[model samples]
Target: MKIKLEKILNLDDGEYRFHFETAARDIGLGLTDYEGHEVFDRPVVTDVVLNKTSHIYYVKLYAASDARFLCDRCLEDARHTITGEFQVAYTDLKSNREVYDSESEVRLIEIHKANEITLDKDVCDTLMLEIPTKVLCKEDCKGLCVQCGANLNEALCEHAVMQMNANN
Candidate 1:
């Protein structure tokens, strides 16, 4: 959830890679899906790349996690993989004031006093935005039988047979 800049801060212009795996809740992403299933029950895996160019640093964060949810159509337990990637830039300056620009995805920080950077908020927002609007067990789900309340994917219900006979 946090990247300690003690090493990267001193290194010259280059790309530094970091990898970590942590619980989703640690990054403030303990959430539930539309069906109330825990969306972040699995651990979040993150890969970070920091590119230092003189006083400017570019950061890219890639995060992924497996989530469990109830199929929207069949109402059965299903698994989904959620992923998010974000990029931001930071400028290290000797100025006393720190500035953040949401529109530009950039921030200015005082490198002399700062030892680390927290990415909890940025990770949370990225993962949350990637949650699927609709979840399904498969591409084609038969769902349930409206008349008999039975899972149509398992088997055809008597009501369906009767309705088909009536129609014919």
Candidate 2:
């Protein structure tokens, strides 16, 4: 998505707000793209606000989606709530160079003398940061029995511990 600066670019100090939504297919996002990923029918919703105080312009982006993920242990369907919030600073300076420092906990994106700004890249980047390293269906997932490959959470297999013990 892109935001035109015809109204805000000329003003020395002002606040502007805009909102947009995108489908998973539109962004080329799929469940297989993530680890143990699952996806429900939900669109990504975003809210953005831009504020200018004197020479400094501040931007905030909020994005959220209802995603489904497979449980890391039992492989059950897990509801994943993914959300991202980003804060950035913009300056209306004439420059062709782009600067980024990944050391900061909160990343900063630079925008130079541009009449408009596209948010697709920034939104996707923020969303990537929200992905969890591990997804679990519950706090304690028993997973599957080693022998029968049955989900222990659903029903305990008769050959669960006994078979392994007898073999030892």
TM-score of each: 0.85, 0.72
lDDT of 2 by residue, 9-94 (tens): 67768888889888765665554634544373478788999897654457799988888878888887888879999877665532
Give a tens-digit lDDT track for model 1, residues 1-168: 777777667888999988878888888988876667667899989899999887667889998999887889888987899899999888776331134454465676665777788787887889889988899999999898887789988988999788779999
Top lDDT model: 1
Task: Choose the strongest candidate by TM-score.
Answer: 1
For model 2, what is the alpha-carbon lDDT of residue 55?
A: 43
Q: Model 1, 63: alpha-carbon shift in Å?
A: 1.0
RMSD of 1: 2.9
Pairs that clash in candidate 2: 38-68
